[model samples]
Target: MSRSYRTVHIRDFHDDDLDGIVVLWEAVHNAVIRPVYSLAEVIASCQEDHAVVAVDGDQVVGAAVGRAAHAQGWVVFFGVSAADADGQIAADLLDALERRMAPLGLAKLSVLVAEHDGRVAALAGNGFGMRHTLRYLERPMPVQRRELDVLGDVGGRILPRHLWEAVAGMSAEKRLLEERLVTPLAHPELAERFGVMPPRAVMLFGPPGTGKTTFAKAVASRLGWPFVELFPSRLGDTAGGMAAALRATFERIGSLEHAVVFIDEVEEIASRRRGDPPSPTQGVTNELLKLVADFRDGSGRLLICATNFVRALDAAFLRHGRFDYVIPIGLPDAAARAAIWGRYVPASVDIDLADLVDRSDGLTPADIEYAARRASQEALARALRTDGGDAEPLGLADYVDALAATRATVSDESARDFLADIEAYGRL
Candidate 1:
């Protein structure tokens, strides 16, 4: 047999390959006197469910068998011949099996392996993580109906775990958030033991485009809680006016078991009060205050209010009892700008990191993202205009040009005012 592993090709299993697959499986688990799965079962799986085999010409080198039930998929059988037990074969077989299973609309795919199985490391390398250890148990079902699903049709979404990790930079802010917000919610038992009561309400005050909304979503992602964004502007235009809509929305939110509710640009409705005539939004503001008070009284929920102009908000809205903390998310510092630039710049591109970082001193995360996008767009446009010639590689010069053209979203005066406001009222 040729030793060139590159000759291996992955394809759907066939009936003729059953004997080879069974031989490979038996060889891998030779220590087991009794078969883990019967030959008949394997044959049936090859005929009925999704199964892929890695073949080196006519020889079956590996097999992966999976089945989808409901919204979950399981890898029931996977084995590679001892002679060809390379990571490449294992990874390819699993990848092929997953490709076949993906279109079946499964939310998750899982595999079970012995704790000591060396294949565990290979599986992890291919993006599988150990979520839990299973010990099968049987329980009686109650006769009554149970509202076990906390995620109702409340317009809330549960973000994946990777999102929090994807949010680069702002280490100081992220650390503070973990300490003040994530810790209390994720580890309530620990918090209680330390006499640290979980914070229910907090305000994220920052200049525009400073990543307040992103941080809110990241918080929800980190906590594994449902993110419910309350669009006050949209709600305000609904029937019975903004106040009534706000009240109804909160009422609906109360049903959720746990939630991280975010209200962005809150000053739209909760702005500073006016003269004797009073603004129409005053009613909405009062309704919001009442809702916050009630929400604060409850447990298993956190309210995150964000505003670009913290000074524009009503004085009562920022009081100690109303909000637990007034966190400030300012413009990205040098380290943060570098992270933002790194995220948007393609790995293949060559650029000056220090120059880009230094030049992006006053830019927000959003501004840097926009600049990066604009640079790419200009590069593509130039390439197109070059009549099919290879485009000049995107480089530091392109970013510098883009930065020159792009205006900073937050002005120097505004930044100074933000700093002044933070000094006067910032809590964290």
Candidate 2:
């Protein structure tokens, strides 16, 4: 008798058995019809969703994965190695997966198989009927099930897809980012043909509230990657201290397939290291430097560090090979200011777009947003006090008043400092 006759046990999938599951998946994939779900989906479901494996001794001979959706349970993956020619193990795996999902109150269990897939008989025997009239379609989700727990632990999230498009202006910055960062990373295959490596780490330095954080989040949304913000202040809350916590955070980040990790006001931790009295941040700075080195070695991840004070960082931290690009984010210009204005002004309100754009010359994106919101709030308050009828709504005058009331986060001295820093340290 063949080794297929040996006793096999069906059990919950262990993390270590992922490799064995991969082998079985590859075996079926190499055969006739391709699996309906991608390998990524199957792997993610195996880890975070429900899964069962049939093990013959130490080898995985068959596997099944399922996901519960309200009253419906869907089979995400089902495969058995060639050794299970009798199809008994395939049936057993399906049974085990169904039992695991029993408590979910699933009224119907279903699966979509590619045309002519050999597992039809096994599924049919397990009481899954053919839905001839029904068709299956899917749009991939940005965040996978497995990454949710890890993402939550790291205070990461999947930003809205509209974020990239919603970035009102900064056309120059947008163009530069698109060419230097987005293009290469988004199209890795094309990038490889041109012999260009996608950027791993980059520094965004500018006057305060210049939308550095917004740009970072937009990039993550555009790339469909998880955005993880590492706050230097919060790191010290861990029992291991800031340096140790920093290391542990990176270790958790490593578990994700792809991520855009941002550290705002990084100068707090990575500032100039001095040996005279041995600065307090020296150890954290050293640990961060090492983390950057290790982060660069990994693929499918980007580290974005933003600082208001570029000159404050350690000289060694800004050296060649540490950051792929040291890009500068400055205040909004004429065209950018106009776009920012358009985003906040209501369509019904007739406002002088050009006048407002020309007036708010030095203001950052955040400043414009605050002014716009304040105008709306004050307009509403005025309307509330008077009779509803003929109550003057928000207008260009309100916006102008709000703009005058708002203070620019970037002052003349800070703006000058930013320009000087760009000339001194800007790489691209």
**Residue pairs in clash, model 1:** none
Q: Note the residue pairs that clash in candidate 2.
A: none
Q: Give candidate 1 misplaced runs (Cα > 4 Å).
A: 1-153
Q: Evaluate residue 296 in candidate 2 and report its C-alpha lDDT on the 0 to 100 scale.
A: 96
TM-score of 2: 0.73
TM-score of each prediction: 0.67, 0.73
Q: Write the per-residue lDDT of candidate 2 for residues 340-378, one digit (tens) a residue.
A: 888889999987899998889899988998999999999
Tens digit per residue, CA lDDT, model 1, 1-428? 11235888888888889888888777666453334455666677788998998888899988888888899998878887766545888888888888899999999898776656666777898889876767334332211123224344456776776678877788899899999999988899999999998999999998999999999999988887778898987897889999999898898888776789999999999999986898989999999999999999899899999999888899999998989999999898787888888888999997788899998889988888889999999998999998999878788889999999889999999899998988987997
RMSD of each: 14.7, 6.0
Residue 237 local lDDT, model 1: 82
In candidate 1, where is summed lDDT lowest over 10 consecutive residues? Answer: 139-148
